[model samples]
Target: MTPNQATSSTTAHLKPTLGSLQLWGIAVGLVISGEYFGWSYGWASAGTLGFTVTALFIAAMYTSFIFSFTELTTAIPHAGGPFAYSKRAFGPLGGFFAGAATLIEFVFAPPAIALAIGAYLNVQFPEINPKTAAVTAYLVFMTLNILGIQIAANFELAVTLLAIFELLVFMGVVSPGFSMSNFTKGGWAGQDHFSLASLPGMFAAIPFAIWFFLAIEGVAMAAEESRNPQRSIPIAYIGGIITLVTLAIGVMVFAGGVGDWTKLANINDPLPQAMKLVVGDNSNWLHMLVWLGLFGLIASFHGIILGYSRQIFALARENYLPLFFAKIHPRFKTPHRAILAGGAIGIAAIYSDELIKIGGQSLTANILTMSVFGALLMYIVSMLSLFKLRRTEPHLVRPFRAPFYPYSPAFALICACICMVTMIYYNLLIFGIFCLFLALAYVYHAMTVGKRSPMQDEADSNSMTTKTPAR
Candidate 1:
């Protein structure tokens, strides 16, 4: 019940089946969908060159943030990820915000990726509606997640490996057609000739640039599930980031070079559209990419379900939500309720796509912005937690310290704030919707969970420490 006891408790019921390889798979799988699509929205906001600049800057921010986040994850090693760190730093209110932000990020991200999956399938089977396919995907993957962590993680590793190789194949097939002239043909779209007006476009491009590496932080959710938490966490994060950066840059440059970047600028299937230029309409290479390419989207869509469910399970276990959601399955030893809860939301999103439309963009853009909104907030609060923890819990065991200390976290925070502002400015409607969701979550917390003390939360979290069947 005390701080010492809470810190020493292994308060997570999730199975400890993950090793460094599985961690690497989940980390990379969580964000690989971004490399497949959603990033071209940046081109719509800021042209080829502008989006490229945005991506480079955002990549640096993510690389630094991931390095810093590992310290907190290794120390707390909880399923809550950012929520656990922020709670230690700023107490219950802070933890609530971080958890809600994470739920929004990981929960909403899948719908976007699922839609992309549907789009890929529709490319082959015209009879199947994209939204219908998306809903089916949600059912299939979330069930796999609930069955067990070992099964889920094994699938993650297999699919992620396939996805990585697929990206490489895409580059090889399209490399010969790379053209600098095409890449720069309409490199700057919004501004007729760069001006003060161009600043807004470039700033607006921030979130879309972020789409390329958005949920890389999801790996932290697996910390409690790692077979060797302290040793595997850092290696997985470092290796995952390195892999993503390489893929992001390679795919972006080659895709841009192959055709008029503007055409694929806002679509959910940018890579397929990009390759269409090189192979015309019927090349076997194009068919192969479209079919095999589904692996990348599936990896993220599936892996994000894992991340969000862990977050849901963690928050519920800590009494931030109803306790039933925290229940571990009696037979599977997995958080079945939490996985179903998130999957229901994702499936609902597929059908609810047309409910609200903003700025003439499709429902997909709104969902994408919502995810970015959550990610930006999580980055800000998590970065703040890093500073607070360093000052308040200096003696806490940290297996890895961020290389630059204050500077690395501080810089990531600065970039996060700037992106948050730009996203709000560009997608005011989406930002407003996010605010409404946050407000409703807080209201629910106040009604059912506001009176709980910090120690009680720790005790509740400790409930997960019971022995479980080995995977």
Candidate 2:
């Protein structure tokens, strides 16, 4: 088949159905799970004070990145997200790098969130195993995604709002118990003095700090399906960052001050644990948090399932992976094959949590590190793509230019570089495994996709095009 024909075929398969509201839901929902669990792990390594600093620093990087990244998403409007942006800027190899990194981020994140979901359920029902609960979640959400985009997105919106409200309620309930003295007690990584010793712990906490806002960028994967990409994408991304930052700081500080922050640091359900200190374990507020908290984890898990499937579909559509994954379900008009494939991988990872351990870390901790590795890499490649495209494609219609031009992207790039270096330094073993995953994927991509011809490039460019931004 000709390149033109392939582009035309892909266009017919993916339908635009999302509006700004749904996009906002997806953006926030993609990372809300971070508040519920993962960020607590940072306390184990960095203490409350140390992790708070790391969270604030990482939050700055995301704020700048979302502002800059909105430009590329508006111009390209491709479901491939970072992959599409990088490909247009630097060609196929760049696309592979960004795509692999994104895949690692989106694909691995769900398993960790799924495990959290299982743990949350285990609290309510002692009989159910967390792994079994996790696997059940994978099956259920994947089916929801395969049903259709609107169905999946509407469901995402509902859960995201519920999750956000629950978080706010948590803060209110814990406010009476919050004390600055408690928060600052041994806050400097268990040291009374803020010496050079705290630096290592602070830097080592980058991944968990990153967890607070990770995958919020996955909203870009829905651009193709957004009713108005230029407007909705910006709103979704900007609003998402602000909401997450506020919640992260609020939740972390409140959780820390209410009780023995050390105990909350290493567990999956920190909010409930902290709440128990404020109100006894039998309190309804504690029960409410345990039950409603599932919404936070579910929102992210379900939204990421949507994100990863679109990514898989885009890569397959562009021939970066097997074409089998590119097929759309005729009745549902969704990437059913891609949805199932990603689910299979996640389910495997869920089970492997017990079977695999590296550096004495659980699969959840290792995958969280691995996910951050991918996020940082994708952030770096994406910023470079932004700069390259500005220099090269001077005429690309940008409805929303990044607020500070070079400065915004430059700041984001530098922060991502620092975080990447810190993560690599602290997680050498996981870093090596991340590299091996990319290397293996690249080997397959090189052998199969090879180099793109001029005709194919033109077709990809055409395929990615959508409505122009209103001047």
The 10 consecutive residues of candidate 2 with the worst lDDT sum are: 4-13
* Model 2 vs. true fold: TM: 0.97
**Candidate 2 residues 1-471, lDDT tens each?**
555335432543578999999999999999999999999888887888888888899999999999999999998899899999999898888989999999999999999999999988988898999999999999999999999999999999999999999999999999999998888888889975687899899998999999999999999999999988988999999888889999999999999999789998767889989999999879999889999999999999999999999999988878788778888999999999999999999888877755446877777888788899999999999999999999998878888899988999999999999999888888898899899999999988878654345567667876675568558
User: CA RMSD for every model?
Assistant: 3.9, 1.6
Question: Which pairs clash in model 2?
Answer: none
Which residue pairs in candidate 1 collide? none
Global lDDT for candidate 1? 0.85
- TM-scores, one per candidate: 0.94, 0.97
| lDDT against the true structure, each candidate | 0.85, 0.90
Evaluated against the true structure, the overall lDDT of model 2 is: 0.90
Model 2 bad stretches (over 4 Å): 1-12, 354-356, 450-452
